[model samples]
Every structure is written in structure tokens, then in C-alpha cells.
Target: MISSANILFEFICFVMALCFLKGNDKFTLFTKLYLGLVCITETSGFLWMMCTNKSNIWIFNIYILFEALYISFGLYHFIKPFKKNVKPLYIATYLIFIAVYLYGSFTRGFFKFQTTAIMVASVLIVFLCLYYYHNLMKSDKIISIRNNLGFWWVAAVLFFYFGSTVYNLFMNVIFSNKPFAYEILVYIMLTLNAILYGIWSYSFICSSRHQKLLTSSY
Candidate 1:
């Protein structure tokens, strides 16, 4: 019987396929790039875990590097649609994250530092999203669009992603001896991530439609 993690991985792959087929045109070029990276990282991580039983530590290390890169780029693009100057800062942060990931991968003692960095980045991204939502809420031009979809979608994604990270961190630090418990936590996180991506794809679709309508009206 396929485990829940396997099932969730399959579902994530299926959703990614559907997103490529149906929502490719809706996403911005940056969004597309980040999404592609995310798909690669996520699938590889899942496969590595399932096949190697955490023995292939290098794969997990690479996965973490790629995931941080993906998140940094994703946030960059997500905000660039409104805040352009922030791109450079995001790039700088990404480089720092990459360095940290590399160090952590090579040195077991540094793993805790990497986890802390990831948590900090995640929190910063959530704050950025909230700031964007606040500005959009006050803007009259696209108030309806922002209110109806953008803000909520961003909030949902941040909530799940951050929540999962917290749980995984706890499992890693506090329940290190319980392998099965750690596996379950990872499975839950993967499922939440897949759901978050689906919501992100839908939000891209909505944003595309709204933009087209606005252009046509003008």
C-alpha cells in the first residue's frame, strides 16, 4: 500500500502538470521560473526521502538549497508585480541563504543555523505579504480584485507554509529520536505545500483575467 506521503507526492505532481497545462499563460515569467524550480525541488525531495530513508543526505541538502532559492524568488516576483525595487534585496538574501545552506549541508553543527535562517526568511515573507495586502486594501484601482482573491490567497499560502515549517522545526529539534513522528510531520508539510501551490496557481489565473479585463476596458 502506498503511504500517505507517496499519495500526496503523486497528487502534487498531478497538480503541477495541470498548472503547466492550464495556467502557464496566466503566470508571470518570474512566477513561472519560481514554480518550475519549486516543482523540481519538491519532487526530488519526496523521491529522495521515499527511496533512501534519509540515507542520501546530500539529496536532502540540495533540496533545502533549492527550496530556499525557490522561496526567495517566489517572494521576489510576487512582490515585484507591485514593488520593483525589492528585487535586489531579495537576490542578496537568496545568495546568503545559498551560502548558509551549503555550509549546513557540509557541517552537521550548522544545520541549526540553516533552520533558523529559513524560519526568519519565512517570517519576513509573511510580513511582506501582509504589507502588500494592506496597501492593496487601501488602493481604489484594484480594490475589488485584491479583496476578492489576492490577499486571501497570499494569507493562506503563508499560513500553511509557515505553520508547516514550525511543526517540522519542532520535530527536528525536539523529537529527534522519533523517526516515525518526524516522517509524519514531513508528510503533513508536503501535503500543505501542495495545497498552497494549487491556491497560488488559481490566484495567478484570477490575476491574469483581471489584468486582461482592465486592459480591454482601457
Candidate 2:
């Protein structure tokens, strides 16, 4: 099942964050926290489904709120190094997300999947990822992408959301028209999760090595 693989990946990322990144920086601390929440949410959702044989949409509905906010904050953290006066943009992004989320919740109900809200969020995140890349390219400072945890982390985010855009956009159509739709969707999700968690695990390794080097140099 997707949850089995997803939970394993999330647990690995969470452990790496704790061992290598906890207290390393504000961003990493938050990342660790976020990963912990992800693990818990995924497990809980899985258990809820197994035990109650009911939809866990409400759990994900709540989790998505945290997910969007944390991702926005992460992007803001990365982008702030290159651009000043970005707080307003960050705030504006939250406002837009909240507006959409509330509207979706009202229209679709809290227990529904809220596809429209997620779609809006995915689009916003993709654009923000592009903006971050643009700023990264324009900056004068030389960066070592190999050891840059932020770069790799953002790259994972970019790949997952941007890569999933088409799938997300036509998810209903695919389910309606395609054979083995559930299997196809699961495979897609697994691939996306592998990409995301693989990069994240590597970033944590880079963070650990980078920290060790920093310590040795001091």
C-alpha cells in the first residue's frame, strides 16, 4: 500500500532530521517538526482507515493546512536570502491560500478533499519555486549545490508539485476514463514520494556533512 511506503520514507526523513538537523538552524528545526507531523498524520490516517473503514479526508484536510503554511515558510526562508521586502509577498500568499481554503471548505465541506484549494496551492508553490530559482540564478554569491541543503530541499518540492501538476489537474478525468485508475494513481504517488523523500534524505546527509566540516574548520 502507498501508506506503507510513504510512512517508511517519512519516518526515515524524520529520523535524519532529528539526528542531523535538529537545532542546526531555524529552518531545519521547523523541517524536523514538519516531518514529525507528517509521520504522525500518515500513520494516523492509515490506522483510521484500517480500524474504522472510513474516509480520512478530514485528517488530510487539516494536514494540508499545515503543509501549505510550512512550505510557504520554507520557500520564504530560502528566498529571503536573495530578496528583501519579501514579507509582504509571503503574507499575501498566505492570504490567498486562506481565502481559497475557506471558500473550498464552505463549498465542498470540511470532510471533502478540497481539490480546488489544493490545486491553487500547487500552482502557487510552483510559481514560488520558479521565483526562488530565478533569484538563485541572479545572486552574485557562489553556491555549492552539492552541499546546499536548501537548494536540494527546494528542488524536491519543485519536482514533486510541478511534476504532479498535470496529474492533479486531470485526476478526476483519469479516474473516470482510465483502466486501473487506482493503481495508476498509486504508482504516480509512489514515484513522487520516492523523488521527494530521496532528495530530502540526501539533503539531510549533506547537512550533516556540512555541519561536521563547519565544526572541524572552527
Best by lDDT: 2
- Note the Cα lDDT for every prediction shown: 0.58, 0.86
lDDT of 1 by residue, 1-218 (tens): 22455455445644544453333443345455555555565467657778877644454455566566655665665566566598786777777666655666577553243565566556656666666676666555555654234554576557765676667477556556766677667567666765675666556556656666667999
For TM-score, the strongest prediction is 2
* Per-model TM-score on C-alpha atoms: 0.68, 0.94
**Residue 9 displacement (Å), model 1:** 6.4
Q: At residue 54, give the lDDT of candidate 2.
A: 100
15-128 in candidate 2: lDDT tens per residue? 887887744567887898899999999999999999999999899999998899888899999899999988787778878988999998998799877777888888899899
* Model 1 CA lDDT for position 28: 48
Clashing pairs in 2: none
